[model samples]
Structure formats: structure tokens, C-alpha cells
Target chain A: MSSSSPEQLLAEIRHHCTQSWTLMEVCGGQTHALLRHGIDQLLPAEIHLIHGPGCPVCVTASERIDQALELAARPEVILCSFGDMLRVPGRQGRNLLAVRAEGGDVRVVYSPLDVLAVAQQHPDRLVVFLAVGFETTAPATALLARRALLAGVPNLTLLVCHVRVPPVLHAMLNAPQCQVQGLLAAGNVCAVMGQAEYNALAAEHRRPIVVTGFSAMELLQGILQAVDQLERGAHRVENGYRRAAAEQGNHAAQALIQQVFHPIDCQWRGLGWIPGGGLALREPFASLAVERRVAPPVSAPASPEQAQGCISGLVLQGLARPSACPHFRRPCTPEQPLGAPMVSSEGACAAYYRYQR
Target chain B: MCLAVPGELVSINEHHDPLWRTGDVSFGGVLRQVSLACVPEAQLGDQLLVHVGMALAVLEP
Candidate 1:
């Protein structure tokens, strides 16, 4: 790790930034940390930081949320998910909490393994874990799937909605309106999946990709590194959070994730579909998928945000600011969220609401 | 959500199968049981970056 302090890193960034440059931080956690610590404000006006669609809850397709609500409502099924997901609005403004309110056995779990315990306790009820996250959270869910399969926990099933970061970044950069000149990748995800994918992305897109952590110091260092690269007209992947991330990442976790899940084209709520963007259970583990047990509802082609008048799609793509939205603090407060971004703590909208507002 | 915390591994529950090994990790004063399946080489007192009850990586001291 660099010995430079946060102030030193900020100074370096300011000195390096001679021209206007737009950089997108591709993780909601980083976005939250940047705003929460006032790091964005501390940066030179030449360095523009745009938040990416890194919040899994914010990116999850409403069709999946509606399906989760459907599964939660089933009398014999107990649907469990992270608390961040419970408030995400689905079809007709319904959510998992609403299903729970109507006496559906929808439970909030801190960990995916907790769902295994819930399954063991209620042997008769089907426990479906709504697995949603990026590479960082995927390995844990993969471990859960492996453990369940090995221990013969037949009652538990996973509604896997885990996504990969690289493809989404590719989609974002490919967009005509994309203003991002460089990128700060999610460090925790890099800690698990490593920097190989990022190296490839950087070389292909010709943009600096810096793996960043969620601390003020780490975020500033990542910015400095990106700015330094941009100033030199050099594009490469740099590990700004070397303490947690590695070049190859955690091999054991990667092996387990590879053994259990395979890439599949999946939908992002507002971003639509991207090929190889999500993971699905493979072969023998496929039996543990919730879709095998319960039928999912046919969803409309339109994204939920369109119907709700939420411009989260544009916001997520870094084309619009959260505060610039007409519905930002009006009918779209956290108490009554019209979209998932407003509900998830890591979301840019929520960060803007809490800190920037 | 990819939120993880650095916690010190206070104790390990060794198992015949390495995949079943677990440990008690302390974050601040609170302690929770975390899976050590990924980091089978993890020893007691090692700081681990834990995410959703699983240790993804060991932080360098």
C-alpha cells in the first residue's frame, strides 16, 4: 500500500488533473464512501466522478423481484434474502415486505448460510434464498450451494440472480452517451475475482481501470492513480487496494464459484440484458434452483422504472444525476421508494439522498 | 451488496474435511462464526475480510 495519506493522495490527484476527465466508480459501496466522506467534493473540478450500476439490489430486474414476491407468497415456501432487497418495488408497487405483511413467510437473512439453517429447521417448508450480488457475494452463495448439496439439504433452493461486473462495465462504456473516461473498479469484487478481467477491459477499452477500496484514503488513492494514468495518456489496470485485492484473487473461492455456477445472459433492471452477465447453477447443482420447484410469472418486456416514472436506468448508466431526477425527493423518498436504487444503501440515489441532499 | 469487514480470527473449529472447517472471528467486540473453507491455511489471529459469513481473503498484516 502507498504511504501517502488521504490528503496527499487528493493533492496528487489535483496536481495530476490538468484537464476535465470523467471517471466512473463501478461499485455502489465506493460511491457511498466517496459521498459519505465528502471525497467527491474534495476532488478538483476537472475530475468528475460518476456512479455506476454496482448495487446488485439496484440492478436486479423487477421481473425477478416480482418472481421473488410470487415465491414468497406461496404457503409452503419461505423466501429469504438480504434486507436491502425487501424494499425494492416490483410489479404494481409490490415488494417482498408487502408479501411478508400479508403473512407470507418472507424472511431477511444476513448471510446465505442462514437460509440453510432456516431450511433445516422447517423441513417441510421450501426455503428459497434470493441470491443477489456481484462476484464478492457470489462465492459465499456458491459455498452455500456446495454445502447444501454435500449435506443433502433437500429443502433449500437458490434463486440465483448474481451478476458479473466486467460485462456491465463493457455495456456502460459501449453506450454512446457514456461520459466515463476512466474507471475505479470495486475492490472487494477484485479481492475475490482478481484483476485479470480488469486488465483485459483496460487494454480493450483503452481506459485506466483502478481497483478501489471503500475507505476515504483508498478511494482517493484510486482516483490519483487513474488521474495519473489519464494525464500520461496511458491505459492500464492498477491495484489501488493492494491490501485486500491480489492479481489472481482468492483461488479457492474462484474454484468453488466455477464448480457451482456458469455464466448466462441475464437482465439488469434498467440496463436490460447483457450476454454472460449473470450466473446460473450448473448440472447437478441445477436441481437446487428455485425455478425447478416453482413456476415463475411471465414478466412484461418493459422495465419497471418506465412504468413508475423513475429514471434510474439513465442514472445507473451515469447519464443522469440522482438529484436531477424530477421525482428524487418528491414521491420517491426512501420511505416510499419507486425504484430499487432509492432502497439500497449502496445505491447512488440513496447516497445522494443521505449525504448530498 | 458487497460489504465486507476485516475481523480477527479468534478461534478455529478444525474438521476432518477441510471444506467443513470454521472459525470464530471478532469484529470490534462482537464475535461471529465464519467459514474458513476458502482460506484453509488461515491461522488464529489472522485478520480476514469476511463477507456474508464467509472469509473471502486474508488481509495483509
Candidate 2:
């Protein structure tokens, strides 16, 4: 509902940003949109925009990717995943693409539900969908689980790696090295999960949380709102993307998620394990979990970053820029990535390489 | 990845079970069948924010 133009919003941000304030945007899509539009360069020098660990592809544990690779390697298992996840390397630089090159059945799916069709077509094979995303994407997987269960599809299973935003936000703010003063919550996530958790986060951390959209104008408006709050010494949750996100969000989607999944301690690749940061299928839908059918190869104790000379941990924590990494462009190009950030399109490293570089 | 596109609902395929309802949404010139189970009240010509073949929210004008 922001009527202000991008120019007006930028001007307002400039007027209010009297002191240096570091703000982290907790969504990879938002990070890509900001860099794509050059919003970071357009902002005042005092307003530093740092990226958070929002890229689901970037945050997915390497062990999980290894498990996916293992599953895909099986002749009877058809592994399906989002396109961005295919290139992310697990331990020893192994990935799904490499498995596919070795004659493994790895398929890139546009939606999780697409696997149901694959399962239906090949009843002899096990169709496993590697579900990796935040709240915005979890609901779709939830719906898929519900439909598959209702239809009694026996061959379809899910490798659920869905993560939550609020817990990660709490983890980031609680870190000793955390420099983020305010946050621009992903609007798409807010559109589904609502603002209640963000409101609590703002109050607990004494920082403003502005639910922001993906457009350049919406990002600017969110920055202005955050700056306005910071300058006034007030901290609260503000909905800058009111057009799509409501205070309560889509009730039906939330209900579906609640019915199908629950939160549990899950590992983020670079950020380490955050309590209640990941989702797993609830008891009713427990039979749909891939792990229940086939045991995942027990991975070595997961290191923060799989590749040496990759500072993705710092990059994910908003402590270091992607370009600051020693192997950023030289050895870590997208074609030959050293970390998940470089592999994922929504990753900060990818955004920097695509835009700033 | 939380990227979602606002598409216009071109048509809805009603089913006996509301969860089975689907819609054809137009994203610019591209038309794709999207699940309308999330936004059951979505009508024709309504703008919807879709992600992963599912309509997540109805956009307000």
C-alpha cells in the first residue's frame, strides 16, 4: 500500500539515515532482486545492506545433498529436486549433477507435486522429491503430501529440508559477531507465515523487522521504513508489502503446513545447526518421508563448509561480503563453485558475481 | 528460494473435493496450470502470487 515512488522512498531513507545502520535481508530472492536492481548502490553509504542465510539451496546441509546423491545413484530411485540444488557440492565436491552424469536418475522439477506424476508413471520406481525451501515453499510441499496421501500414492516420498525464517533470524541476532541492526523480512514468507513471529523477533531483539517485497521500489520502501524506525528509536514489525501479505497471512496455507509438518532442530550448511530451524513431516504424514523407506548414508561429521578456502560461513552470517572471500571469482566461479552460495542463483555470492562483479 | 510471481487467474477447474481444484494462470503471456487449493476463493481474472505450481496468495489491486 506504499504510494511513495522509489525516488521518494530513497530520499526518505537518506533523510532518516543519520548514523550507520546495518540491515540484513533474510531472503535470497530479495537479495537477488536488490542486486539486480542496484538497490544497494543506490542506498546511502551509511545504510549497509547485508545478506542473510535465506537461500534455501545455500543453507541446505551438504550431508543432505550427499544423501540425495546416494538416493539418486540407486537404480530404482528417481531423485527430483529444484534446479538450483543440482549443482551444490556435498563433501568431496560430489553433487547431484555428477551423479546424473554417471547415469543416475536425477530430475529437476518445477514443483514438488511434479514427482507424484513421475511416481504414477513408474510404479516400479521410487520417486523421491528433495523438498528444500522456506515457509513460502513448504505449503506447496504440504499440499503435495496431502494430495499424495489422499490418492494413496505408495511410491512417492519426500526428503524434506524445509527451513523456518524466524528461528534463523533469532540465531543471527543472538550471535556474538552479529552486526545487523534491523531486518527486511522476506515478504513472500510473510505472505504465507504472517508477522506474528517477526513481531516477537523485533521486540526480543529490539530491532525493526520490515516485511519487504521483491520489487526495487518495495525494497527501497522497506529500507525507508526501517531507517525511520531506527531514527525514531522505535522497534516494531512493519508490513511494507501489504498488497500481498496480510497480518495473519493465508490461513489455508498455514493450516496445511501445520497439518503436514512440524519444526525440529536442523542443520544449515554455513550457519551450523539452529534449534527448530527445519521442518519434518508430522506423524500423520510420516510415512511420506524418504528416510523411513531408505536409510541415508551416515555422513561424516559435517564441517561448516565442504570446500577449503571458501568463506561461505562468514558470507552466510553477514560478517563478510562474497567478494571478500579469497577464492570468490578465481577458483569459485559458478561453473566450478566451491560453495553453495556460488552454486545457487539466489545466493549472495551468486548475486555479487552476477551483478557487482 | 522464495521467489513468487503474480499471475492472473484465467480459469478455474472445480472439483468435488476443494483440495483438488486447479486453475490456469497467465504469467504475462505464459499460461500454466497452477494449484488453487491454497486460495480456494480465487476467481477468474484475480491476480494471484504463485510459487512452485501453487497459488499462495491473492494480490490486492
Candidate 3:
């Protein structure tokens, strides 16, 4: 299979390209891979790749960041989260790193369970872990919650913000402005939640959803499959990342997530509340939830003027590209990010800045 | 962060505490320690899709 190189795959894709096809890769990782390898440049002009709202950091609600910032300010609390999330600007331009600069005890953790060790060591203090991301990350946080329950760690609390892919895809497809003709599904997410959930969505929307991995060859192959499907007028769920993804996905991970988390209507930053879009701790693990312990200061929602010409909302919706934003390279570079898309490595703006721009 | 890379499990250490069971995962040539707490069923030489120092799923291939 390695002998049939990306060049060979590109030939196949070029042969199948007979019309204009606007496809959205649902994961930011794929977006980066495509740009890094120049796969997008190799594709036929008709095959337009639209970046989707797959970056967890880009889609995470600002209110949740405000809550994290509030928790980090407490003298008895130790806030832990992934590295990129620290720089994502919340409401009023404040972030966890900014709070840490002001003596807030916010630390970067490699894993959610690392906070469990922190909680064990500092029994007197509260260890609040920011649980974020899609299905790929949900299992890890859920496992941490179950372990916390089993270990009986009373000091650990989770600020949950897990999301699902299928629901958001459904919302995007149903939206009147959506121009996406096909999709490259997030492989890691499908590895946990399985591909069955996408079947109905594919049939209903009449758009092929191909589950793909991060490698350039995998993505090119996925795009090839999607384009072929579009050409044939066949809309179904295809597994291009068969080596890691399966039809049913990881059942053990799914079971663990189900035990620890329940679906809730959660708000996405650029996109508003999506029904059953996010996850919160289930009743059994409610005590470990951070929202119950700390009351976040509710600031007024961000105004259009406050967004400061950052069209991340349009970018996330695939209506506009990152470079299309007026402030994209001018004031919204990764070093001085005006939005989460610039701060997070997986964000579309960051990917475009590093590669295309 | 939803970004995860596929790594090959080199070995599994059963001597340590079971809850903290760990294995050495090699992504291409880079090696790192990953927790097997979530995937207790993971065996030696398994390809795991690792995220944030934890093996979230085992690749069938």
C-alpha cells in the first residue's frame, strides 16, 4: 500500500474531478495536514476544501473560559488544562495565562488524570481540571472522573465542555448558508463515537461523510473517495481511515463516557447553543463538577465591537476563509491572537497562517 | 485538544500499580510513556491512537 504513493492517489483524484465540489474537513488537524503537505494545492481547482469548526479550542464557549479564569483566581484552587487552552482569549480579553500572571495557580497538565495526582498530593486545596474537546477527548476525562470516584478524591472537580461531531454537522448541514457538498469526518472522534451515528445524517443530507486520518495520503484518499461519491450521486458514510477507525468505534471508551457524562445543550463560542451539543458530568459524578463548587461572575455577552473585526464566526461556519478576515494577518497573528482560531494550533487561522498565508 | 497521533505500543509494564499501568508508545521514531488505564485490554505491539498521554483507542491494523 505504501508503494501506491500520494502522487498515485492524486492522479486518481484528478481523474475523478469532473465538477466543482466544496468539501469541509471536520477536524482542524486534517486542515493542518492538508496545508503542510500542499495536498490542497495539488487538488483540482474544482475541489475546494473548506475548514470546519473542529478545533475544540476554537469552538469552546467563552463563558466556560470565564469560569476557568474565575476558578483559577481562588486561593485554594489549582486550575489545570491543556497548554493551548491557556492562551485562548475569553470575554474581555482575559485568559488563564493572564490570570496565572496575576498569581492565580493555573498550571498546564498533559493529561486529565495528572490532576488526580495533584489532588492526591494537595488534599487541602481544590484541583480543578478543564475538560474540553470532542469525542476523542471525552473518554479520557470520563475515565478520570470514574477514577476520582473510585479513589474518592474529594478535592478534584471537572469543568466539563465535551462536544459531539454528528450533532454539529447536522446543525451545519441544516443551516441555510451551508455550501458544503461533502465532508471528511474527524477520524479520532469517530474512533470513540463510531461511524454508525453518521449514517442517518449522510442519508438525510445527501452528502458523503468520509472518516479520515491525519496523514496526507489518508486525507487525499478521503477526498478522492468523497469526490467519487459526489460524482456518482452516492451519499453514504465511508471509512477511509480503516486502520484506526471502525464501524462501531471503541465500545469501551463509549461505555466509560456514558457512565461519567450526560448530554446537555451547550453553547459553542462562535456558534450559539446546539442542542445535546455538549457533555456535563452525570448525576453520579455531579459532586466532582466545578460549576457546582464555584460561582463564576457573569459578564455581559461579548458585543460585535468587542470582537474587533475578527470574523472567526464566519470562518468557523465555512462561509469565509481565514485570510478573508480583515484583521487576519494585520492584527490577528498567532503571536497576538484576537480569537481562539489564532491561539490554538489546530485552529483554521493558525493553519492558514503557518502554511497558505 | 482533539489532535492525536497513532503510535505502536513497544511494551507493557504489569509490575506497577494496575491503575497506573503504562506502556512505551513510539510515534514514528519518537517514544513517550502513555497510560493504559482506559484501555486495559491493550496488548503488546498494539497500535494505539494516543491523546494527552492516554491511549484512547486501539487501531485494529
Please write out the lDDT profile of model 1 over residues A1-357, one tens digit for every residue: 364588777777777789999999999999999998998888998889899999999988788888898888889999999999999998678889889999999888988878889999999999999999999999889888988999999999999999999999998888788889999999999999999999989998899999999999888888888988999999999998888998899999999899999999998888989889999999899999998987777774555678768999888998899999999988898878988889999988999999955
Backbone clashes under 3 angstroms, per model:
0, 0, 0
Residue-level error in angstroms, candidate 1, position A32: 0.5
lDDT against true structure, model 2? 0.90
Ranking by DockQ: 2, 1, 3
Candidates 2 and 3: which is better by DockQ? 2
Q: Please give, for residues B1-61, the per-residue lDDT of candidate 1 as tens digits.
A: 8999999999999999767789999999799999998898799999999999999889999
Model 2, span A131-201: residue lDDT tens: 99999999999999999999999999999999998999999899888999999999999999899999899
Give TM-scores for every candidate, taking all chains together and pairing residue i with residue i: 0.98, 0.98, 0.95
lDDT of each: 0.90, 0.90, 0.87
User: What lDDT would candidate 1 get against the real structure?
Assistant: 0.90
Q: What is the lDDT of residue A181 in candidate 1?
A: 96
Docking class of 1: high
Expressed as tens digits, the lDDT of each residue in A38-121 for candidate 3 is: 988889899999999999998988888888888899899999999999988887777888899999999898888788899999
The residue-level lDDT of candidate 1 at A243 comes to 89
RMSD of model 3 against the true structure: 2.0
Q: Given candidate 2, what's the lDDT at residue A204?
A: 96
Query: Which residue pairs collide, candidate 1?
Result: none
